[model samples]
Target chain A: MTSVVAQQIPYDSAAPYRSLSLNTATTKRWTLAEAVDGAARAGLGAIGLWRDRVDEVGATTAAKIVADAGLRVSSLCRGGFLTGREHGPAALDDNRRAIDDAATLRTRELVMVMGGIPDRDLAGARARVEERLALLVPYAAERGVRLALEPLHPMFCADRAVISTLAQALSMAEPHPSETVGVVVDTFHLWWDPTLADQIAQAGAAGRISSYQVCDWLNPMAPDPLLSRGMMGDGVIDFAAIGRWVRDAGYRGDVEVEIFNATVWSSDGHEVIETMKRRYRELVLPSLVG
Target chain B: MTSVVAQQIPYDSAAPYRSLSLNTATTKRWTLAEAVDGAARAGLGAIGLWRDRVDEVGATTAAKIVADAGLRVSSLCRGGFLTGREHGPAALDDNRRAIDDAATLRTRELVMVMGGIPDRDLAGARARVEERLALLVPYAAERGVRLALEPLHPMFCADRAVISTLAQALSMAEPHPSETVGVVVDTFHLWWDPTLADQIAQAGAAGRISSYQVCDWLNPMAPDPLLSRGMMGDGVIDFAAIGRWVRDAGYRGDVEVEIFNATVWSSDGHEVIETMKRRYRELVLPSLVG
Candidate 1:
């Protein structure tokens, strides 16, 4: 633990480092070793992983790579999508494997994107999420991994995730212990919520915010909603206000930068990392610390 | 009151038409007279007018057109857009004119789409909406017009309306009386809300639910979010669930079919109206009465 803390050099000692984690999605082209080394080289304290990237190089080797790099695995990308009637068994088995992967990667949080409305039944899809999440709780707890329910933007309710607010995620997570089940506070998905500040506070008070992801919701959302996430300062989200709320909520954890945009992906990975660092320092870091 | 009720032919006497209204936007290319005739010919009891269409023939002539066709003007399309610092006077003047037009058309509800983020300050923009809304309340009340605050979908927070939920709109309308200040529960904008049922009930109890609009939210939202709205059954929205909540909230107002998809707009106006009627009958009407 001492050595791990020693290796994370503060990007600026004057301000010190608030836990900064780089989600691999921000640099989509990077391999596991590249992302781990890149995050470590940039003085970041942690890295968030995607399942496909972990599967590329088996979870064991991926875990060793991150561990050897002296970086913590802040979170694993996803584990839910458990809303299909015909696909339930396979999805549950896949989520179980994701839980094992999270444990192997040395991360407590496994992000869960409850699947979209399977057929035209939004209510049923959401109900399935609650039911499936309950089934996974014991397995996730046994593996020492917390299922982090992520409420995606409402725009994605039909195709991506039906859980569309932190409040909904928290309600779903309420039945379980906070240590076994948690919620993710992703700025891009939730910045537009009117009750955002209060919800963030509630999540904090409940100790349920397992991950704090930062990305911007770009204006005139991309033709494809999936590619509409922008870098921190590129969109209209008021990060300072939201960041302050997260910090005040008692979240002393990794602030992961997770962006998904074609333009961001097409740029040089190293340059993208640099821009993320600069923007975090300029726009988000102060709010968390101030 | 007796004459008004006598003129409204129930689309189906068995069903007891629950204030069926057509927003001119659904038939985008139609002139005010054409839309009025189309709405009346189809036995729709009311019409919701857009300012541009009303301005085309002047409000007095537009009012005469609806009256001649024995249709009530359910609502004027909009009045707010008051987020700009330099455009205050122009916005106020326009809203005042809209109030006059609502009176001229014998409708109490004048829908307001409070403008989106002007510059980068979302809090400031929202504050401006509150301030501007306060200024318009007395003027609206004097004209016997209710400023119906319509919450646009969160997807439109950047370019269109920033008030993104019924809760936010209700909070904004709280300072004024329900008679002069009310809220709109448009299914396309609000079907995704988890607390929707409660909010609708709250609005109903307060007598602040001025209007209820229906349109489906297409899966692959249109390239332009404005054109993403489809006819009721054509998309993935659970109309029955939302329609039930609207009815339970005591909203006996027009369920305005206000779709804006490019395909719907480009089709024959009369055919589009037929599809709207059929979809409403099949998907939305049942929930309201059942």
Candidate 2:
């Protein structure tokens, strides 16, 4: 029998520069209050709260708990589902509510997953997203909330989001160039992008980059989409290289650890948060500091 | 019991402009000669031959058989694996052979699948691929062969191809800027690309668009990576819209049906070719024609 000793890599020791931010999905099994308190107890630097979690425990209370615990709010879970159909007006309304929540929480950024084709016509859906964003940008600007357009993986195109590349999202976010209308570069989504470095530079030059989320794309395929993401340093993505590029591109933002894994969420929140914090410190922080 | 009538879509009456170009993998069960005869029998307008198949049947003899059978050689099935450390020189040699074979068969384009990471470092692999392409571009130019860089799905980033987006590919092919070093806009690989239409437009504007390949992406996930492609109209992809976009972008190339499905390939070649021809005419051709 082959024994695999999965040891936790310590982040606080080697790379204090690497900051840990718990994406609420990491404790999806826990209540919003539980996640916030658990994240604080684990000594994570920050937390990324989801709209649903905030909604479950009133956003005001959630904000108070997070602040009381003295944890930084890195980013709000989401604010965009800019599909043409099913989620058009509803998505916009939801995003407005999300913006309000982020403002109350005092989060630095509101992550947006640009929803995919509403009626299976991708091009048409993309046009609609652009139009919707055009309307939403000014309102977001007014709220002082940055709309971080997060490009989802291409595999998520049909059901999740159509904006599957940093370059595409950057182009869409171009017309409404505001600190409010920046792009979120998630490693899980943008790691495979061939023009990742170039686009990161472009985003930096344009001052449209807002958030940097980290998660690894696991190999041999995982059965579930949400839970299959590998922890940092476990997969094929060159996170160190990406971290270096992001830094070079003038993104002095938080290196948020936003993993969406059901297994991790189902496990002890403290354990998951600690592991992520350690991995971020060891694998990702050194490159940034160097 | 569910009564399934198996929709009978006529091949010839579906679309006037819909032309079928069989990529030999659609009938891996059949020899290259068999595919040619079967394609001719099914009234397919064109066929994309593989280098191995040409080697199996002899390139000169395969050309004669295809010519005698009245089949247009749409494009050859690949000439690039320029990524791995040890395979660079060997890949170049194989590409030269492919170019020679394409020229012998009078095929207009040679599809190239960029290889992925050597040691699981995706960024390094992408840099290697770009370097190798730079080296091979002059040789491909001299041979008068258009090397169509096929940007594969990001899921294939670790094992198949590092180039995962049309935008990334266009940027890589930008510096060279020649008809000889163009791009292949394959529906399966590129359907999820958020910036597909824009990149296709860019490719067309640069006069670097060589081939357009069509195949559907299956949903509910496939167990096998290579053989899980769906038949046109059976999956989530809006092929009609993509076809129109490519056509509008000035890509006047054959819409080659390159399905790599074990189930389809295991079927009678006659039936497979006929069904593809029918679907192309009915579902794909009219959209582009208008």
Candidate 3:
């Protein structure tokens, strides 16, 4: 017979740090240096640099400018597209350059978009991707740059990526247990995953969970092969739940907001960043904290 | 030593009966009786019925008409929206009615659309759905109406269905070990599935594989939600491969063509059915036969 003390736990009203990481595609209108400057001025935490942007500004100069702006590099945008004959030598060479770029930028991860079928042969394409990944893993590991395999949405399965689920990504990375090979779970691609909770947990257990990207899938009237993504909170993604799940899975990484909306990109970049930050603080952070 | 012989299989090179099943939605412009008439006239082996269409012209009458027309009932259109107070009761009642309707029609399967959040609680909504499903299982089992949990696309996850992945649906059906509870693996919903092959195999092994619905996911924009679906070979689904896989998995069910497109519907329903038949003959049936 113990008397229970009535004590109310104080609610944490303050939100988590709304670290703004601008995926350079958000401001494809701006150059790499310009994007870096814009991000710095906007009080952003980091910037995800793309290959084309680096090529445009020259890798060394882009690296220097980013360092100068006092901005952390979130990730290097992509280094995998193992599908076409054009993809063979060209993709490998491009990936090698991307690895070098990631090392130069001091980026934590090099996002890999595993290309899908070239000859409508899915199994063959997947095999080729695995072979390429096996070859690239050692090189990436030696460079101290983790290769984050980004599983594209199944809509992109025909021409973009055969690895269409986070579980599949984890499976792909299982053979290479090294931290060098990891998986990037983007909400746009994986929010629909029924086994999301289990897969995320599995990724955490394996120490292969690299980056957590947030985006909403727009309910388009017609399917556009490219450039039709929703702004976070505007669509039907349980971001807060996902954020909490990922955090619980021991992902102490930055929650990178990566929206690939043509509509949002067409508008003011500054406004979009501010709106995203507000949403991140209000909608996403509370769930994670609780 | 195995010798490669160029032997021509005497099956109709111009027409394939195996790939042809009429989904009533393709002829939404026509009444249920008319659809049955058209299906029988086209010499289609199977036909999928919808609850709304059945309701329009009483379930008993629809059943009689289908039976009179001499067509195999592939599946009955839907029976699950397990969420919300008002909607939940309505949904359960509706599902019971649908089960009865399916049974009356002598349909092999009753497809279930697992409804999304009553309000905005995705996790809670999902739990509610599972609870309701558990309750409905025995009822469905008793009636000999196999409940095929159809996982809707993620875009429909907000308002239409909480169960947006085939794996989730399969998991829900896992508890019920009998063939009474199963899943309908629709290409529109599951083509994007990362673990599609594995899940299909799992569904087959569990004896939960009930029906296979086909509709191409169109690339172009459309205005209506219900009538924007692509016809076979008109969009980007690997039907041949999927059909082969389904056949290999021992799915001896109807390859039902269920296209919900305004363009096709506005055109002659007979022509639409004919085009689907042609595509089935040329592209789909060959893959299954192989």
Which digits, one per residue and each the tens of the lDDT, describe model 2 over residues A1-290?
A: 11111111233434363366778876778887788788777776677888888887787888888889877778888877777665457778888888888778887488888776656577778887888888787777776777888888887787778888888888888888557688988888888876688989999899888777888877755656555587887778787889888878877656677676666666777787778877887778877666
Off by more than 4 A, model 2: A1-18, A84-89, A134-143, A175-177, A223-228, A262-268, B1-19, B55-61, B120-123, B134-144, B170-179, B219-228, B248-250, B262-268
Measured on C-alpha atoms, candidate 2 has an lDDT of: 0.76
Instruction: Report the alpha-carbon TM-score of model 1 versus the true structure.
Output: 0.95
lDDT of the candidates, in the order given: 0.86, 0.76, 0.76
Q: Could you tell me the TM-score of candidate 3?
A: 0.87
Question: Which candidate's TM-score is highest?
Answer: 1
RMSD of each: 3.0, 8.4, 8.7
Q: Write the per-residue lDDT of candidate 1 for residues A1-290, one digit (tens) a residue.
A: 10111112223436333378899999999998898888888878889999999999999999999989888888998898898866478889999999989988888889999888867788888888888999999988887888999999888888889899999999999999998899999998998888899999999999899988999988868887789999988898989999899989988788899999999999988888889989998888888777
Candidate closest to the true structure, highest DockQ:
1
DockQ ranking, best first? 1, 2, 3
* Total clashes in model 1, counting residue pairs 3 or more apart in sequence or in different chains: 0
Clashing pairs in 1: none
The reply for model 1, stretches above 4 Å from the true place, is: A1-18, B1-18
How much DockQ does model 1 earn?
A: 0.72
Candidate 3 ranges beyond 4 A from true positions: A1-19, A85-87, A217-228, A286-290, B1-19, B85-87, B118-120, B217-229, B286-290
